[model samples]
Target: MAKFRLLPDEQLARSPFKQLWREFSRQHSAIAGLLIFSLFFLLVLLSAVLTPHDPYLQNDSLLLLPPSWSQQGLVQYPFGTDDLGRDLFSRLLVGARYTFGIAMITVMGALVMGLLLGTLAGMTKGLKSSVLNHLLDLALTIPSLLLAIIIVAILGPGLQNTTWAIMLALLPQFVHGIRNAIAEQLNQDYVIAYRLDGANNWQVFSRIILPNIWEKLTLMATMALSTATLDIAALGFLGLGAQAPTAEWGAMIADSLDLIYIAPVSVAIPGLLIFLAVLSVNLVGDGLRNAAKKRREN
Candidate 1:
């Protein structure tokens, strides 16, 4: 009798989470980015519990206090006081909340709009595609910052208006990307087979197309989040977003500009938070792309 050998267990294959973790671990920059972002996120989430004082409370006596290292120093303000004598550290924490909140809302809104438009345009041919494609091109050609400024200027500056401006600026790029991805998948044999089985368009999209395109969608969402965060900060810096005493990172930086020499920490804290937040998002995007590529190869 021939000797029988047992086949290797399929269950022993690497899990998705394991694969992702392994891939992410090899990316040092991505890991560093993740840590920095986590710190900021934690600071935001625990602001009420962690802050040394009410972020809005004014202490005129401590106004523009220099950092601990300065000669006039070792003051009660750890990161020094802003122009209004609000604790820079406390404001920085609240600023993280504002920045992250705006970014999340804008990204989510744009993702929803883009996915619907892209799906409709990609699945249909001829006139529908042509109309959408042209519209997307027109939107894409306008610089996001310029478009946002124009829209916000018309609508007047407020949180809701800023969110809308961000969505408008970001939606077109996501629409284009999703459309291209769907169009490419449409040519695959599996998609063609599904269509031939008398499956409805909605059925095919929900069951077949959406699952296959999730990776790309995730990547796009990450990029959109990063862009939205930066854009919101920029608007705040320009005095068109969040407004005064709102504890937004950009607005904090703007408020601290004149005191840069007197209290560098006031500017540094918020600026650092903004930089780390954007950097984390970008690193996460890169990691996702690398992981997806590896998955496809396997």
Candidate 2:
């Protein structure tokens, strides 16, 4: 008889959180993106606490003041004041809150709905799958921005409505991704073995298929976050999102467009923030996908 030694729990199952941290640290671009995102998030969370002045309050006398480091500018307005004399720095901080809020809600809503629908279609196959797939194809054929604009038009403009519009625009992408992942999972040997062991369809799907495809779904969610951020900014530029007095990044840019020549940094600040945010999300998503692939390979 061969003797076997039991492995410690730590050895048997490594900490996934630690593994994830390590993987994230290995990717320089991902680390940079994460740091930028973290800084943005800190600004958002501390906006009310750290902002030197109320973002909505206006001092007509101080309008169009250049950034603080400029020769004649004051320390109170680090990024400067907008046309309305509101603190640009404060507004930017608050804007981060709105931008992140919309992206998160829209992406999460789309992910949940897409995952449920896709899993059902993939597992069912036959006529049901064909019908669902056809519908997905139709949705994919339509321009996401156009669809979002129409949805927002009908719903009218507000933060919640904008999020819903974004979710509708992004749902099709998630649905397609989930459906393909699930379909692939169904053909795996583990699924076949589970089916042969007299496991019911629900059990096989919930236990076997869902777990296998979760990583891919996570990557899709991260990508959707980036897309939703851009979509929200576009909507704001079109005068259909976040509305006035909200201090949203997109709305800030739209409000500052007239002053672009005189105070270009006003427009540039928000645009730069948006660019960094989107780039960060994409980098993080790509890193996660690569990390997951490596883990599976190992």
- Each model's TM-score? 0.91, 0.91
Per-model clash counts, in order, read 0, 0
Where does candidate 1 stray beyond 4 Å? 1-17, 69-76
Candidate 2 is scored at a TM of 0.91
lDDT for model 2 comes to 0.86
Query: Cα deviation of 15 in candidate 1 (Å)?
Result: 4.5
lDDT of each: 0.83, 0.86
Q: Return the top candidate by TM-score.
A: 2
lDDT of 2 by residue, 22-92 (tens): 66689999889888878876876777788778989999899899999999788989988988899998888
Q: What digit string (tens of lDDT, one per residue) describes model 1 on residues 1-298?
A: 8997644333323355465566677888878877876786686678779887899999889888777777876556677777777787778777777888678878888999999999988999898789989989998999888888888999999767888998999989989999999999889999899989998899988999898898899899988888899999999999998888899999888887987877778788788778879889899889878977776665
